[model samples]
Target chain A: MKRIVLLVAAVFAATMPAASAAGPVDITFLHAMPGPLGQALKQIVDGFNATQQEVRVRAEFAGNYDQLLQKTMAQLAAGQRPDLAQLEVSLVPRLAAGGHLLPLNPLLNMGNWQDFWPVFRRQATLASIGGTVWSIPFNNSDPVLYYNRSMFDEARIATPPATWDALLEAARGLTQPGRVTGLGLILSDIWILEGTIWSAGGEVLSDDGQHLLLDSPEALRAVDYWARAVREGTARVYPDIQSWQADFAAGRVAMGFGSIVSWRFLQPQIRFPLSVARMPYISRPAVPVGGANLAIFKDIAADQRQATWQFVEWLTEPAQQARWAGLTGYLPVRRSATTNPQYAPLLNLPATPSLKVGIDQLPFARPRPTAPGYVQVQVEMRNMLEQILLQGADPRGVVRQTVERANRILAEEATR
Target chain B: MRKARPVQDTLVLLVTAVFAAPLVWMVLTAVKSQADVYMGPLWPRSVHLENFRLAWETAPFGRYFLNSLVVASVTTASVLLTSILAAYAFARLRFAGRDWLFLLALGTLMVPGEVLLVPNFVTVKRLGWLDTYAALVVPFAASAFGIFVLRQTFRKLPVELEEAMFVDGASPWTVLWRLYVPVTLTSAAAAAIFVFLGAWNALVWPLVVTGSTAMRTVQVGLASLIYDQGYNLPVLMAAATLVALPVLLVYFAFQRLVVEAALQSGLKS
Candidate 1:
């Protein structure tokens, strides 16, 4: 079968006519949104194009965030930069380290910079990069607790757990032998783990941003809290995020932690009642933001730069963001968009799992660690958790080792 | 040996099941509704053929198919042409450092394609071919794999065959097109098939080079369904099944030739 791959000659004209330069200041945008999400983004871009005549934005889907970064860097190296790039937040620090990102502060003259969700602003900013925001938050989301409402009722629970201790207890009660595992733990993203650490009054990174504090007493406590549930047979670690969502939709797991955006993928498959609530905290209520950001290159034409900024600004405006949030379940980067008339329907959206809780928890939202090497470090943190929860390894020992490895990576990144 | 036949047959069935499981699963998922996808019976209790229609409607897949068809076809043709010429010269023609140059061409295969991705992309951009078919087809036009296969095939041919052609007043070009190429049909076909497949399945390079939807390919469209949220497994599976159909048909039709041609390349080497 592999041998016969595309053997015959294609008679159709292969050469696509290059985009003409005669349009209204044609500019390119590289993004990572896919499927309906890409459609939503395209719709918004189309609206912007329809309403304007000075500049035309051509948005391109460049695989995913990692792929987008590669394309952006390659194009930047060739001095053929895309007008805009949608980058994941952690990627901003590494890209800014390349010194090719146009620091957004100078281009963003609008007063709406402050109107963006503070979490998003902080998420897209790097103090080490001259305290400048390198990217603007676009498709931002924070983790929330997703649970089976039917199982909670069956367990005779009155409300979803509000604290870490209560969550563990609920997991213990919700467990029906040979039926439902209480919680399905996602071992991919460190945002949930970081949020948990913060809720335990511990920080994932130090104030100086020089080290990971995962080995700190509070952080270790947070790790142990989840690991304890796993050891008790009330929870199980899912190999990946998709599997966790699938299990929850299948009613195999009573509870799980996922982003506000997960509902769009899970709601169509769910058969039982579901509920979303604030991320349960060990000590206090806090959540870490996760999602992609929009950035621009440093060396675009002056007119193109202004035009690109105008498009970027238009994309993040309250009205467009509200529509984007409605079409796609991504949280709007701007606070004003949540209160926009279009966003009101989603807050009380008719579904077993509504994502309004993610917005409700925004006041306590914080940014994840965004060091140049943090992307690599996240793998270590996730691995450590997977070991503890899935393999019954001792949490304290794993935490110490993971923190040491993380700091070493950060040190190497700093020197580079 | 005769008594062990049943055990071997059982083993073969197990291996076949292992290989066929995913393909079977994909077909089932394509027909299953969203409700059945997450939790229902392994063999779907109900089938929805409209799932394919829904998957097709979700995005501009028809446009993607056209792009992929054009890109793959143009690329495969170019690769075969270039490889035949290069391989013929390397195999039959006398030149200084002949073996060394062939070795140098072959050494390119040793470097991971990913390592060359950035430099190649930069070069393509500088050449002002970005978003054109040339950017997609030209860079992959001359593959070391294709050259190696054809060269091996050409080298294995008795020298008297080419000498006999030249004795009959055939030019090197005629000897190549009329004599060498047809005589080496099996290996060349193998090389063409392999080259076409690479061009067809490519995602990252094509995604980076082309910017507009009109230039997008099926693989890119498939990749777009897979985002941070997760796959709509049924729709994604349906689209994948649709994408696999033409290739499956081609493979089944050329099954014996593909195997024979592949064997020819390996045996000559």
Candidate 2:
């Protein structure tokens, strides 16, 4: 028995170094993307691994954005952080403040950083941290108007709405009492709320990130418009994203606001001809840039960090961006990606026109508030919107209370 | 009492049916087409078995099942062994600070599992066990709840029986395995069921420790199905049905023993 044990131990010891030497450097990439987008991300990672000799990237499907944040924070506290993560843009400032993310500016040398659309570039910049670029934008998207063409035709609307007033008018025209609601708005997400505030010429946070600006008249006007719409039976707020998406796909809603990312998933399910339009503006066309960005954790080995940057840079390349945009419904972050020969066929497809509209709206896209307490603020905003839209609370009073609560939370966060 | 029998039977049937409705709905939804799902029909217009096949192909569920099986089985076996030993010492053996020590073990029941997530994760990482079966199985090997349950059952065993074994020159180990364990077999089985279910259904710890698909358990795999496939209710329901099958089978098989064990534990205590 002792001899056998000795032989087994010797064999195991001998195989250790051989295995280590033969294996590529393994790095973990945590992401929250699910479904077709997740599959597309896997393809990109597989492509990178096939061409590389040094680093093998493993794309892990961490739950959604909130779950990803929780897991990453837990891992960080445990000293077992992944080499790379895809974080929401609004979360970058908080994570960077925690000293959990590595600054990419020092490692980046190849890509034309300026090639990124101005909106994406601004969103990816961590102004609180010496204005350094901390993450590379990936799967970037903006809200657009997804209207059922058949419903629009039945309502005698010749064109999609171009302004908030026109949108309300079209919504009112499409209502069929108990049969179909005119519009479905997702009240749970802060992205749409921020976009509405911006379109109404109100900012969510001041330039210095010290105070709330939603108490302005423009912000109140936007909130009141949505509240009145809901109360007037022209629009209904769904409980969650899936509920609203299902309502639209089931022909229960005529028009809805959704991210461009919804196109790939919703296209197959909807039986009607779905048309996309730029988000209807109140004063000027402005939508907040939404989606995730690639962030490298600070604790990875230096060589692994270099390899991670290589993968990030490769993923953001014009050709790769075009491929990703084509596979997923996300907007390509690079200007040259739209003109790339490889993507020309994708751009000519019927489904690409809506994406074209999304692309055109990029110039007017705005970044979400980057306050460290912004996540909590988003919850407050959602609650306030729910109160106003669902409970018939006075819009102006709710807006004022919500802003005051947000400002207090920001103040507490500042001291921390 | 005889006249109340039919009423009791009817009430039982109604409650059982109520409890079973969601499971039946899940199975029905699993076979429904995506378009047929939202139509609010009780049954699919046409049975679409393709959702199950598509769900299986979407992720490596076979690997997830194997991972969950191995982790859960090893964890259950370890828990039984450790709990039996600890419970025997507490119930049968005379030792210094025995009561204090058992009290300490029971004290852990108050700490929520969620509060230990970060600390346990850190300890596992420090032991170089991240992404390994050791991370999933070892931290959970000795469940305090298992020890407490087994200890209660052990104390309820007739002390005269153990004394008879001792008088017959039987070793303590002999007394435990040969005499005490047999008498408390039902309780042990109940403890095993609880431990197995806990290990099988665990999500947060396994998700935190394991990053590779190769190490992910079925619960995590089922969750990932929802992230991308939330709109595809049929596929999601299919995946969920597949994940719940093994646990349901286990429960159905030992349900009589489980009920007897529960009644005995409560009555004896």
Candidate 3:
């Protein structure tokens, strides 16, 4: 028995190193990419795994952005949070304020920060939350106008609209009564509304992020344009955002406003010639940059956090970013990625015209409001817009009441 | 009255068709080509059977289905065992604080499962059960509704049955298995179906507990399909059809047990 035990101990000691060498540090990365975007993200993750031996990222699809947020919060409260997660840009304030995210300043200093676009860097910075950088930008996008070139040509229009007044003129000319609606407005999210408000020279919140500014004259003017368009039969608001995309793809709507990432899905479905253009402006060109960012949770172990940072660094490398942008329709977060030789072929695809328009508009892209209670504010804004466009509520009265309610919510959140 | 019978049958058929139309539409859409999906016709221009292949390839649905099956079956079997024992005690055994304990168990019904998500998650994490089959199956092993229904059914049985079993020198375990279980199979089957469906269709708890694709259930797998394949209605519908097929089959196979359970309970009253 003594001899057998000694032999077993020797065998166990001999094999331990082999086991440790083959087993990489395992890390979980929760994300909300769906469909083709999910596929593209998986390829990137798989690529990272194949290239490394020290870290293995287990990517879990945590539903859509809202669902991912809920899961992350619940897991954090339970003390079993993933090492890393993909968070929507708007969620930065709430997560950082709650102390759920790890500040990325130490990791960002390690040579990845300088390559990011200034816009993305600013979006990732949380000034109100002690100026700690909380996330790294990924899958960034801006809303652009998706128009049917055939419809424009049939209307005797030579070019897509460049301003709000021209948009109205184009809508009037493109409206075919029973045959085709001129514009299909998506009332589901606040991205388009933010762009409209910005174009009319209004801010969703005050500079300090403590007040609601939707009741301003600029915002009212923008909403009134939407209301008049809907009332005049030149525009229709779908019950859901996806229906607008579907109608646009089916040639039932002449123009639609959606994320530039939508090109990956919409390009193959449209039977007619599709044209992409900048979002029609009002006083000046302005659009809100929308996308998700990678946030590491604070509760993970040191080694796991290190592994996660390594994966994040690899993900943001110029070559990887170019490949990711080429596979997915999101604008490359790094400016240097566009000039990379590998991205040249991607830039020449048929979808490049629309992508170019989005890239050109990037200079004016502003981050969505990152106030603590901004999600509630978005909900109120959507409800107000829906009422004004669909129910014909007076734009001025609805905007005033909505802003008052939003301000009350923000104040309540502040006290908490 | 004879003429009214046809009209009544026609109305019932119409209602049934109305209830089944969405499922029919899903199957039809699942078989449609991408272009035909949006063409607004009930019938497809050409059937694209490849949608199922594409949907299956998109996610690890085979693993998800297997995980859901194991979780559902294990949970249902455990729920049945625990519920039967507890119900027998409540219905037949007389002990101190028996009624109070039963009431306490019943009180748990008032608290919604959603309210317990965080605390339960914490408990599971402390046990180091995250991303394990135990995390999926253990927390849901016993159900209050199952106990309540079985206890009600057991109480409705005559006391003479237990007396006879005792007089015959049978133990409590034997009495439960030989007498109570045989007579209450219908109610047990009903409880089993409820537990099975609950476990199979669960999304939030499984999604919360497991953080890897290998541990995901079919419900989570199907949800991921929506974000990735939301544009391709055919593939989305095909995946939905696959996820739902098991539950529909289970319900169809056990529906008679539910009907008989309702009838038996009614007759006892």
What's the CA error at residue B99 for candidate 1, in Å? 2.3
Tens-place lDDT per residue, model 1, A108-186, is 4667777877787777667877888798888888888888888888889999899999999999999986888998888
- Candidate 2 deviant stretches above 4 angstroms: A1-26, A52-55, A78-80, A106-111, A340-342, A346-354, B1-10, B91-100, B156-172, B178-180, B228-230, B265-269
The C-alpha interface RMSD of every prediction is 1.3, 2.5, 2.5
For candidate 1, the TM-score of chain A alone versus the native chain A is: 0.91
TM-score of each: 0.91, 0.90, 0.91
Question: Candidate 2 — what's its lDDT?
Answer: 0.84
The ten-residue window of minimal lDDT in model 2 chain A covers A345-354
Q: Candidate 3 at A124: error in angstroms?
A: 0.7
List, residue by residue over B1-269, the lDDT tens digit for candidate 2. Answer: 35668888999999999999999999999998776665557877889898898888777899999999999999999999999999999987899999999999999999998889888988998999988999999999998898998898888888988899899999999999998788888888888888999999998788888888889899887776664323577888998899889988888777888888877766743
Clashing pairs in 3: A34-B227, A34-B228, A35-B227, A35-B228
CA displacement after TM-score superposition, residue B226 of candidate 1 (Å): 1.6
The A-chain TM-scores of all the candidates are 0.91, 0.91, 0.91
Name the runs in model 3 displaced over 4 angstroms.
A1-25, A106-115, A340-342, A346-353, B1-4, B158-175, B262-268
Which residue segments of model 1 deviate by more than 4 Å? A1-23, A106-113, A340-353, B1-5, B160-175, B262-269
| Backbone clashes in model 1, listed as residue pairs | none
